[model samples]
Target: MKFNQYIFLLFSLFFLMSNSYAEINIKKCKANQGDYIIFDEYDSQIAEKIIDYKLHNQPEKRENSIIKIFANENSDDRNYWLASIQTDNKAEDYLFYQVDQNKFTEVDQQQFQILLPKIVECNQIKEVPIYSENFDAD
Candidate 1:
């Protein structure tokens, strides 16, 4: 009887905690480059431009959001950066991009596919290079 009571209490507590939790807010999008983009709101258009990003929606997503874009002598592109946008939850699952400086011309496109699909409570997302010495790589 005592075991049953404890089990019931545990489940009740779990339900309450889950209900009290809120949807994750994208505080920042960390990318591979030396820079990162921050998004308080969901902007599908902006997210398409950035190359690599880390979504702070959850721990799994946060860790998965870390995308790596490598540039080398053989690489054609010299400059690469990460960008993110705040979009409405009801908006399209995929983010479409257009040229803002060129009067909304279609320049490029990126799909908001999560490389990391787990959710972690993150206050902010800052760019931290995987191979950077600052992160104790040495």
Candidate 2:
């Protein structure tokens, strides 16, 4: 009975620790109006453009909201960056993106948590307008 109790306690502690580690704290930030561009790890011109292009064309679909950007480059020699966006809405829809592909891919929250540390470490999370004078120089 004592041995069983010890095992149960050990399992409980492991479960708690694992759960704590799995939970990643993503800072909530305002999404600035305009474009959110994440440059590719290899090429500056190649970027993932996050914007509501329909703001002028499809006003009905436009939602007034901000997006928080999280990004990081892969460790391998191949140039790749893992990026994620969280909207400033109550629902907080989180979307993951592969900058090289310029497309959003389905990813589990667990995966998000794993890459988050690296994302915050190497990338600067900032809000930039969709249309910027800086873009004109490119």
Clashes of each: 15, 5
Give candidate 2's TM-score: 0.35
Tens digits of per-residue lDDT for model 1, 1-138: 999999999999999977663332232322233233332222332333332222334444333332332111111221222223223242222222222321211112232233112111121232332121112322
lDDT (Cα atoms) of all candidates against the true structure: 0.29, 0.40
By lDDT, the best candidate is 2
lDDT for model 2: 0.40
